[model samples]
Target: MMGPTHALSAGVAFLAVATPMSHYVHHLTPATAAVGTVVAAGAGILPDFDHRQATPARAFGPLSAALAWTIGKLAGGHRHGTHSIIGTGVFVALAAAATLNPWALAATLWLCMGLAVRALWKHPPNRPNGKLDYRDVAGLIHAAIAAYIAYQLVHSGLDMGVVPWAVAVGYLVHLIGDSMTEMGVNWLWPHPRRYRIASIDTGKTVEKRVVVPALYVGLAATVYLTYPKWGPVLLHTLQPTTG
Candidate 1:
């Protein structure tokens, strides 16, 4: 799937999961949910950093290039190494260690890895070269990461209760959205054979037809959901403030 589609799908997932999770956690503050959504969307994008030549690496200049080069050199280029399950696990561990919030870190890492694996196996066209798809392994790693994150979110010191669920839901949304595309996600990879829902040719059109509308609708819904009563609040906070 293209970057835009991935991003839109990720955003939709973020909102879909965050809203309900927030309510469940009793932290239904608009601000917390919104922040969670944004974070989830960003997590969706993190896996694509494997594409060294992509705009993101280019945009960051030497720093991005260096990072991409290192990843490529260490992992064997996009979709081959870093796009694998093992790679995702490594990343998740690193992220968790860095953040010192093992649960949140794990969740974000798992979500990204799962998405990556699904993308890799389902959309063979994305891979171009035929190779053993390790997406299933990646998905497992993602699951582990997500589980850890969930545990942390529930037990962590943060007063907020909804962030972890929102993040996980957002990630799930990303996976489901990818499945709708022509290059459907590898719902099952590293099995006897590869399975996919859409063909590469149709994937682009599917993205245009499905993801675009969904993004617009999601944005509208988010705005409506977050709208203030009595009067609109200017300069909305990323997270809702406690009175």
Candidate 2:
């Protein structure tokens, strides 16, 4: 239910120094700072794995597809498993596990990428099995590139320690955003019943026009308030200068 924009905004909000999460991540060095942001923001898109057309699924391709298939099959597909506490637990567990061994994680990603490429090239998308659609090719490439970027970041001296927490925080933020939608999440595990705000709808005028703009504002505000580049200046302006 949470759109990519809102989820990313929530991630940014969580990353902001003003947020509770800042205590753990505020000490990050310049190089790893953006990496932290990327981890969090990327994680924000995790819940949407059920929707093949969703950006998270598109960006992650076969990796997302596999996860979606597995969880969906377990919870009756799209919008059910991924929206429940049990499903969320599965996501967070996978995220935490990946950070424990970056090399193995990278290898898994490579395998997924290879499969995606094969699906796009060797096999036709229309097999009637709905495994790999022709439209998924571009997304697979993008997902592969994202996977490579993470691999390089791991190899290039970035701390993997920050990853699991960032991913968890981002995933939770996505859930919160989705809770605001009319079709809310099942939040409780093993229970299919959903809960929502009862007023908001996904992709409606309110979401596109109001919610999206609000997300932009929230992102901008978070950056202005917490970004190292701008935070110091804002604080400096707020404090009375010592003559």
Candidate 3:
């Protein structure tokens, strides 16, 4: 699946789980829920960081490119170690650890938000005259904004409890997305066998027509179903406070 599709699927998955979980998990405030959703969307492309050519790798220019190179080597190339069940656990653990410290959490959020913007935002295509692409500049602007938001969240003392589960679900959704592709993923790495439940070509007709639409519908349905709970909170957040 494409980066945008992976991200959309992960965001949808987070809401799907969070909607029901909210009923039982009383601490899931609107702020935390919003953060979790964004985090999940970002983490959806986390596995793709193992590929230098992936969207997340191109997100932050040389810095992300260098990280991707190191990760690709450590992960034994794309769709190998990072696409496995083991990789999910590792990422979740890292997220949990990041939540333990405000600075670390802020950094994590910044990275995730940057990744989310790069995947979700539709920047202009490259110029036909071989001029500079506004896409790269747009990414930098988004990165700056993401940094500010991350800092604000950390400063607000927002609950960090939801980070781990968001990361886990988002990462798993990514793996699941790839598993449905024609190439499939190595669910259990080092086993030398790829597993897939369906074969949909990435960015092709099946994904474009079926899977993408289903994800959008699912996102809308889950939002509608849970509006009764989070809707007021969102409205309240948006409302101006009396001095």
Task: Please report the candidate that would top lDDT against the real structure.
Answer: 3
- Per-residue CA lDDT of model 1 for 175-213, tens digit only, reads 454455454444333222223455444356876788567
Better of 2 and 3 by lDDT: 3
lDDT of 3 by residue, 11-67 (tens): 988987886666776368877888889899999999999988788877765567678
Candidate 2, run of 10 with poorest lDDT: 118-127
Give each model a TM-score.
0.53, 0.72, 0.88
Question: What overall lDDT goes with each candidate model?
Answer: 0.49, 0.59, 0.82
**In terms of TM-score, how similar is model 3 to the real structure?**
0.88
lDDT of 2 at 29: 49
The model with the greater lDDT, 1 or 3, is 3
Task: Please report, as a residue range, the 10-residue window in candidate 3 with the lowest summed lDDT.
Answer: 123-132
Candidate 2, residues 66-176: lDDT per residue as tens digits?
A: 665665577776667777777768766776687678775564334333322332233233223356665567556656675686577668765555555655666677777
Q: In model 1, which regions exceed 4 Å deviation? A: 23-28, 84-88, 101-195, 200-210, 225-243
> For model 2, what is the alpha-carbon lDDT of residue 213?
73
